[model samples]
Target chain A: MTYCVGIRLNAGLVFLSDSRTNAGMDHISTYRKMIIYEKTDDRFMVLLSAGNLSISQSVRELLQVEKIDGHEEEGKSGEPITIWNATSMFDAARVLGATVRRVFEQDGRALKQAGIDFNASFIFGGQIKGEAMRMFLVYSAGNFIEATGETCYYQVGESKYGKPILDRVITPATPLNQAAKCALVSMDSTLKSNLSVGLPLDLLVYREGEFSSNDIVCIDDKNPYFKMIHETWGQRLHEVFQGIDDPRWDGGDSAHPMMVRSARYDTMRKITHPGERIV
Target chain B: MTYCVGIRLNAGLVFLSDSRTNAGMDHISTYRKMIIYEKTDDRFMVLLSAGNLSISQSVRELLQVEKIDGHEEEGKSGEPITIWNATSMFDAARVLGATVRRVFEQDGRALKQAGIDFNASFIFGGQIKGEAMRMFLVYSAGNFIEATGETCYYQVGESKYGKPILDRVITPATPLNQAAKCALVSMDSTLKSNLSVGLPLDLLVYREGEFSSNDIVCIDDKNPYFKMIHETWGQRLHEVFQGIDDPRWDGGDSAHPMMVRSARYDTMRKITHPGERIV
Candidate 1:
């Protein structure tokens, strides 16, 4: 079990990952799930992974030097291109997909025999020297889908618990720091609801064209901002919830009445007696 | 997919369920998931179910006359007894479990042969005369576990998206109306994030000693309070989130600084070059 998120916005990219992993409740452990690839002025990419630890680790290790058939533009007719030398983020993602496929080919049979699925997925995103910042969700089968305006973020593992706020607040135009804030808040909700997702967190914010960044931090329980987020979000949320008027069952002249007159009410179904029919 | 929730509070019980069901995206349909059994002042119970619709529907049909051997005291050594004759909520729950087992015995093999799971679960709770109110989560195997003060609530199907709110707000002492308000809010979050859970909700709130309640309503997309909740909650949540200070990347002299010094930072993992090793 794990939780990781990647957001591509107009301002930059925000990546967050939790470190908790568990084979069972008794086997809880810490393992970082974020990786950064930096070539200074050339390219900047980040990978956030979730699923079988072994498969993801193999994919990450192979992704750096994994080669693919390059188009003739790179050099010779069939030069091998790696993530380090690829000219575009799409090419890098292809190399990553190939890496995943290789690992699956090697481990898929044995894992299936042992009753384990070849489960591995990743959020791979960043900027190449010339192209705009891009992001993708790479599936276990080595296929991938890019993030777009309607869905500018990708999350894997324990994602549903943290999705509502992201749905309500995120857009392509959200500012860099604010999206980072949103990512942390989303992670906070996840950490609160799931025992298998936890801190210290690995958070990295990459500016749109920076090819690299210093905005990386490892957040343990004591970090001031995360602690404030954990405390204030819940308390303010409680205050906000209290601010909303309670449902008025009386059907009086209230501003917000829980019971409204509607024809659809008659269409509702309920079985009230032993001999009652469903109809 | 479906969403059903039941809460046991000191004030009474609150049950909420959505009516959406889907075998696949192409086969989405509406099906009520809550059942009410009441004999006025004598006893009252509600069933909120989720899982394979067929199994649940069968279990519900069988539960009424589905009897088990009554204890010797009930009559001549082994007279029939059912939920209608059960005195304690615990005994009533046992009757419900037995009804589930009967359905399993009838359909389990056929479902397994077709590769469909014998899946079904229920949030069954209510007050029976001569006993305190109780709630149980009935699983597929017909085994059940009672809700306690610490847990206070149970949710089935598409549950995680709606759970954080419940985790933050619910308790045994929470007032009945507020708990109802909280339940609707939880459902609202689930609706926003999941297309499989749709409009027209079934909500019922029973008071501690009332035995039965008139405070039942079927809320559709047009309901005003729900519309208010759907709008105000997201807006207010955004406001609350905005009030929380954004993470300070610069480590400025602010009230909340995101980055603080910690020894664990040195142990953080990152890959800066193609040849970099994990250790």
Candidate 2:
């Protein structure tokens, strides 16, 4: 299992992925699941993948050389229609979809024969010279969906544990570093709750119109910022939890009381005697 | 989808379930997924269920009269070994498991033929005379696993969204109301993240020694306490998030910084020209 998230905002795109992969409890391994496709002034893109290793590797390998119909016509043979020359992020994603389908065509049947799902999901997002930054969640079927104003981010695999913070913090106008902080906090929550998602984490922060820069880092247990986040967030969260007054059964002095009278219904019905049913 | 959680603590047990069910997005209904069976001085049990509605309903129905093989020998003819008369919580859970299998025997084949799983999961917990309080997660196969000191809670369906907070807060020594508050907070997180899990909610709080009490409540949209929790938790969480200073990139006066210089690798790689890939 893996947890990968990509956010595309007006400011730019942010990408993060955990490196833990496990065949079982005893077979855990660390594998990088993020790839960068950059052509600075021309285009900059990132790919974050989750699911079976073989499938993702195939997709990555094929993506470098794979082509969509138009891309193949544009690029010379052997040069390959790579992420480099794509006119738009949409076309780049299509190249990605084609790469995924190529892997599926090659291994989907054999995997199905072994009762394994051809499950692979990708968060592909970036900026091209002519268009705004965009983000997409590519599915196993080679189909894809883009994020919009209402939903400005895409997360694939082990997404739930990290979602609440994202839901609370992200916006199209959020600054790049704030979004990065939110992503790390989200990753921290996921790490606390789930074993399959671990560190060192791959984090990339992109600023709009810059194509790309040196904002990526691998966060291990020893990284000071991550270490501070891991400790501060947990301690502060517990403080907040404790700060919230516990429920007061007697409607005590606290401004926020737990036991409040209601007009809607009585307490739950219970069967207190043998053969009794309170309906 | 539904969300139900059961926690066994040193002080007592806590059970919480949502009341939303949907056949499709177009057809939604509210159905309570909790039931209580008690015989005052003898026993006190609560059942929280999730999964296929028909199967769960059938299991619930069967539980009224379902008896296990060994327990039947102790009953008289035509007098069902009901939950009320079950001598121990384990036996009561076995009866619940048998009830589930009986439902499977009746509809499992037809459901399988229709490509729908005969899925139903339950969290059954309570205290029976002469035994300590216990909690069990009963599965479709009629096999069950108990919650011991190490793991004090069980959740079924739409559980992941709300799991992090519970993981952080729950312990054997947590007070009953606080645990109940944690369960509600958990449910709130699930409700916010998942459309399939909605209100009203069914909450049951149990005490260790008391056989029964009037602490259970059906919390609908209009319930004041729930309304407060929904509003306060979201607001307070946002406050906490804001209070935590945003990431500082240059290690200014802020106590926590975002970027930590490392010797291992350069920041994320970028390509400056078309056809360039970061290797």
Candidate 3:
């Protein structure tokens, strides 16, 4: 299993991915799942993938040469559309979708015969020279959906354990570095709860309009910043929990009392005999 | 979809369940998913169910009168074992499992023909006289596994979003009130991230050595203590996040910096042309 998250904010974009892959409990290995595509001053893109490693690796290898016909008139010198020359992020994502479909056509039949589902998903986001930053969640079927201002992020694989933090903290106006910190915090929660997602994280911070970014790092257990985050966040969360008053069940004259019964639903039913029914 | 959690600490047991049920996005309704059984001074048990509501409701209705043959014989009248007369919690759980199997025998074929899986799970926990507290996770096939000291809790249905908090905060030594607070916090996380699990929650707390518990409450949106929890937890979490320093990208003289690159892997590969390959 893998856990990867990408955020597109007004200030920039943030990307993070864990490096563990497992076929079963005993067959665990480290596999990096992030790739960067940058043509300086032209476009910059990042792909974070999760699901079957074989399928994603195949899609990544095929993506460079994958092509969709240009919409130009016949007999004209229109180059075949590719990620490198695609004018908009939307078109680049379509190229990615086509690449995924190509791989599915190659491997989907054999995998289905083996009773394996065609499971793969990707978080693709980047900036082209003339366009604003865009993010997409591309599915195994070669279909995709873009992020909007109202929903500014996408996460794939082992997502639920780390979701509440992202739902609470991220917004369109968050700064790039701050969003990066939040992503790490979210990842910390996931790492603590789930063994399938392990360390040696890949993190990238892309500033808006830069077209290319150098803010990339690999974080293992030795990374001092992430170590501080792991320790401090857990300690501080426990402190916060301790500070809150426990529920008052005695109906005391407290600001919040838990003893009050709901008016809408009756108190829970307790059966005392063999023939008792709840209603 | 539903979310229900049951935790057994050395001090006692805690159970919490959400009350929303949905056939589809358009067909949403409220149905409570918890039931209690208590023969005061004899035994006390709580059942939390998740899956097909019809199946669970059927199992609950059938469980009261469901009987297992007793081993006693030799012309003596041995009353068929029922939950009310079961000598141990394990025997009670078997009866519950047999009830589930009976329901499946009646409806499993029709449900499978309609393309719906006969999915159901339950978290059943309590104490009967002469036995220590026991908790079992009962499945659709009438097989069950008991929770131990190492894994002192069980969750049924839509459980992942709420798991991190419980993992962080719960242990065998945790006090009853604190564990109750932890369960509520877990439920809050699930409710915030998932629309299918909603309020009017049923929460029950049972103390060790007590055959019955009156600490049952139905909590709705208007419950003041839960309202305080919802507000204070979000606010404190935000405050904790703000208190942490953002990552330093410029290699400043800070203890933690985000600019260091990985020594193990090269920077991600870039494809500049249509025929470019990663290798």
Model 2 chain B: ten consecutive residues of lowest lDDT = B263-272
**What fraction of the reference structure's interface contacts does model 1 contain?**
0.71
Q: Report how far off residue A182 is in candidate 2 (Å).
A: 1.1
Cα error, candidate 1, residue B153 (Å): 0.3
Give candidate 2 regions above 4 Å deviation: A71-81, A250-279, B71-81, B251-257, B262-279
Cα lDDT listed for each candidate: 0.89, 0.82, 0.89
Q: What TM-score would chain A of each candidate receive against the reference chain A?
A: 0.94, 0.92, 0.95
iRMSD, per candidate, in listed order: 2.4, 3.0, 2.6
Q: What is the Cα-based TM-score of model 1?
A: 0.95
**Over the full model, what C-alpha lDDT does candidate 2 score relative to the true structure?**
0.82
lDDT of 1 by residue, B154-203 (tens): 99999999999999999999998889889999999999999999877999
Looking at candidate 1 chain A, the ten consecutive residues that score lowest on lDDT are A270-279
DockQ-based CAPRI category assigned to the predicted complex of candidate 2 = medium
Model 3 misplaced stretches (Cα beyond 4 Å): A73-77, A261-265, A274-279, B72-79, B261-279
Question: Please, what's the RMSD in Å of model 1?
Answer: 2.5
Per-residue lDDT for A3 in model 3? 96
Give the TM-score, chain B only, in order for the candidates. Answer: 0.95, 0.91, 0.94
Q: What DockQ results do all the predictions give, each relative to the true complex?
A: 0.62, 0.49, 0.59
Question: Which ten-residue region of model 2 chain A has the weakest summed lDDT?
Answer: A261-270
